[model samples]
Target: MKYLVMVQGTQADYEGMRGKPSPGSPAWSEAELAAMYAYMGAISNDLSETGELVDAQGLAEPARTRLVTAGEDGKPVITDGPYSETKELMAGYWVLECESLERVTEIAARVTRCPGPEGITDYPVVIRPILDGAGDI
Candidate 1:
């Protein structure tokens, strides 16, 4: 089975990445940031070696996003983001071929433990099975 794992980020998360310290919040030091990247790279390499990694990518800032909807007259309505009050935005995603949903969930759990701002280890990782062929769909 193939699964998609998504990491969520918020505005505060983006600010932290930009070295902007939130009120009473500690900025991520260069070494910490390096360690975070290293950890992610290591895991990706491991998955690749195991032949489970299908694809992985980190997204650009959500501020660059655009939302399109149908207008009253059937025209397009476009809105630029970074939407205020949004709970979270998709920060990155990984597609992995695993034996089962449990395996994917385990991978997601490990990803959530990857180092982040202020040494936090509680990031959310959403996982969903990928429907491939027409029969699966």
Candidate 2:
């Protein structure tokens, strides 16, 4: 089965883990930040070695995003960032071709341990099965 591992986090989550300290808080050392990235890379590398990794990439922050919708006359309407009512963002994703959902879930669980800030940092990875093209005309 092919699965999409959606890595969820915000820009704040990225910065906090990468050594940007909040007011009066200590910063993460360069080594710590490097280790975090290294861990993520290692996971990808392992999956690739096993021929399970189809694709993986990190996304630009929401500030660099744009929203497009249809206007009243059906023309394209564009809006700048800070999309309303959204709390979590998809920081990155990994596409893996694996044997089973249980295996994909295991991979996602390991991703949750990929190092983060001091407390309550939301770094969630969800595993979803890809649809196979069957019963099509």
Q: How does each model score on TM-score?
A: 0.88, 0.85
Who wins the TM-score comparison?
Answer: 1
- Candidate 2 TM-score, C-alpha based: 0.85
lDDT per residue (tens digit) for residues 20-57 in model 2: 66643236677767877899999999999999999999
lDDT of 1 by residue, 1-137 (tens): 88989988776666677687764334677887898789888888999999999999988888888999999999999999989878688888889999988888888888878875663425578998899887986
Clashes of each: 0, 0
Candidate 1 segments whose C-alpha is farther than 4 A from its true place: 23-26, 119-121, 133-137
Residue pair clashes in candidate 1: none
Q: Could you give the C-alpha RMSD of every candidate to the true structure, in order shown?
A: 2.1, 3.0
| Deviation (Å) of 133 in candidate 2 | 2.4
Which ten residues in a row are the worst by lDDT in model 2?
17-26
